[model samples]
Target: MSQNSGTEILRYTAFSADPAGGNPAGVVLDASGLDAAAMLAVAAELGYSESAFLTGRNEPGHDGPPAVREYTIRYFSPKAEVPFCGHATVAAALALAERDGPGDLVFRTSAGPVPVTVAREGGELRATLTSVAPEVMDIAPDDLAEALAALDWPAGDLDPALPPRIAYAGARHLVVAAATRERLADLDYDFARLEALMHRLDLTTLQLVWRSSSTVFHVRDPFPVGGVVEDPATGAAAAAFGAYARALGLVPDTATLTLHQGEDLGRPGTLTVELRSDDVRVRVSGTGTRIEG
Candidate 1:
């Protein structure tokens, strides 16, 4: 425990070194005393897409920061709790790294245990989080149609290569790709309609993307389920997309994909997704920096 379980929330942006870029995530280093309601209230107060709370170290009787290695982590959106959150995980790990120095740590999330490795590259600290075993499934016809209707995107605008699917890494995301970059850039959507569909589907976000190249993609995330219009940079969605791509054989099993996001929102950030043939889990890496008051 770092603080008195008081209001010591640290803000950080993940996936981008610049505080003004990436997705801003509020991190409560120690929330041993905060209940679910309190954590939700804190997340709502922060008004970020998602926030992370470190409930406690996994090991019992571990005193001080020196003895702690693994942690019990929880994630919450402004509206509700999520099983996992990648950007927030990155932010929380970076916050710990700044104090304890870069190293390996495990976060016990609702989905599964996520192993994170942090290292300093040059002057900045970067972290890579390995997601839980991923699953990809074909989207329901009705659901696919409803999603397209909510976005006001024509069926013809979808890229045939990518197809439509629901992918799960730490959280579930609906993966859809636009045939053209222009189609992806225009993102005004029916929030209520999309929110309803997402709720029914039990999805966290819609992974909207356009393929810039075989290994590079421009992406966006519609997070109406999280009570947010869009996520600036979504590491969770990136991880899910990695699984989707690999499962569909859109990319080689062993490949590194670059995701460029938040550009249209003016909070430009980059995320790297690495896929390995031997492992069903995906690894997402990015830089994070503290947002000082």
Candidate 2:
């Protein structure tokens, strides 16, 4: 066993019920003593792209049900701290569910308030997170061209239907819809260039997508900013993409969007995005399993 001093680390893969699939993240149940530097060190040691540090709790004798859990949660990558993370959120929710049973959970993040719900459906336990209000914007032509060049992809490979836009729900991501599955599958990009651009634009990841159907899409996220080359499955980007589809009238008023991700990485996972007619906060659900220590 390796000698290290810190909080107990639990490993789990989010968005997939199997341990082999989805995005793996380190979960720290309580990070009371750990500071920012300590958290970063722990995440670097784990090196699972992103790790969650859970700090604080609801006041002892507070209001009924506790709408606000008062968590000073932080997300650390191998290099630095991020404002928010999607797959890590799912992992955190499932971890909470294992101990507290299936119910509603509130996570107070650096970005904003995130509400997650867990329920048992058959043998699988599904966790759904309701994102903050979402918004979308146009991508600058020069930026788009540079991004395409870095990916070694031609502009013709882009989908005309979905187009390109910068989307934001809990965090910001640039949504670029590819014309074909082949275009989406091949993901070799200039890491340094993309990272520089993302840093300049204040982007979390590039939400590269391909529309399989009106209600089905395939997604791959490039997260150079987080010090990860690619994210196997990204729940926060999904929420932002869902909002993009709805706002642009790409899908029906009430629809179930199935996202197939991580196939190219050999860690296939599924994410279900539900868009409601009345509510703007998108619901993203998926299954996760604990990774053996």
lDDT of each: 0.94, 0.88
Give lDDT tens digits, candidate 1, residues 1-293.
Answer: 21323668999999999988999999998889899999999999889999999999865555545443799999999999999999999999999998888899999999999999999999999999999999999988999999999999999999999999999999999999999999999999999999999999999999999999999999999999999999999988999999999999999999999999999999999999999989999999999899887
- For model 1, name the residue pairs that clash: none
Full-model lDDT, candidate 2: 0.88
- Report the lDDT tens digits of candidate 2 across residue range 25-72: 998878888899999999999988898889877664654656534456
Worst 10 residues of 1 by lDDT: 59-68
Error of 2 at 52 (Å): 1.0
Off by over 4 Å in 1: 1-5, 60-68
TM-score of 2: 0.96
TM values, all candidates: 0.96, 0.96
On the 0 to 100 scale, the lDDT of residue 201 in model 1 is 94
RMSD of 2: 1.7
